[model samples]
Target: AQSVSQHNHHVILSEAASLELGCNYSYGGTVNLFWYVQYPGQHLQLLLKYFSGDPLVKGIKGFEAEFIKSKFSFNLRKPSVQWSDTAEYFCARPRGGNTGKLIFGQGTTLQVKP
Candidate 1:
């Protein structure tokens, strides 16, 4: 079965610090990738996604992800982050056959200090 893995389990950063969280998947076929963020006491929000086209995909709030087909990796990056960016991030992908089931990574918690 396909799965997602996040390199960092927890991250602490001060304001205006650059951030890069690694994400990799174990899949050999065509795939769609997504990054979701959940702020404190808030619902999961879609940070960014990469289905096709350009390898570099940008999303809301200065967030972006790159899809490297050769490496089976989709790493999220932000040049600078704010305290408001603190949250839990999850890397995910839909299961095969369009079952609507998603496989998510263990997740990484980012704590941004003011």
Candidate 2:
């Protein structure tokens, strides 16, 4: 079965610390990758995506990720994170075949202490 998994259920970090969240998928064919973040009281927004181009992709708010094809992983990283970066991060993939729905992993909650 095709699915996505986020290794961290919750994270706590001080401001200006480095951040890395693990993500892995179990699909063997072509797939679309996405990272969505929902801040406190805000709607989910696209952090980044990997779709047919370069495997290294950058997104809003100083976030980036690299897609490792052989490992089936797309891990999110940031050099220094701010308190505002605190939010729920969800890794999603578009369902393959005719259905265009999205499959989201159980989100990772990031808490940054100021």
**How would you encode candidate 1's per-residue C-alpha lDDT over 1-114 as one tens digit per residue?**
888999899999999999999899997555989999999999999999888899999999999999988898999999999999999999999877767578899999999999
Stretches of model 1 off by over 4 angstroms after superposition:
none
lDDT of 2 by residue, 1-114 (tens): 679999899999999999999899986556789999999999999999998789999999899999999999999999999999999999989777757678899999999999
Clashing pairs in 1: none
Lowest lDDT block of 10, candidate 1: 94-103
Best by TM-score: 1
Span of 10 residues, lowest total lDDT, candidate 2? 94-103
Number of the top lDDT candidate? 1
TM-score of 1: 0.96
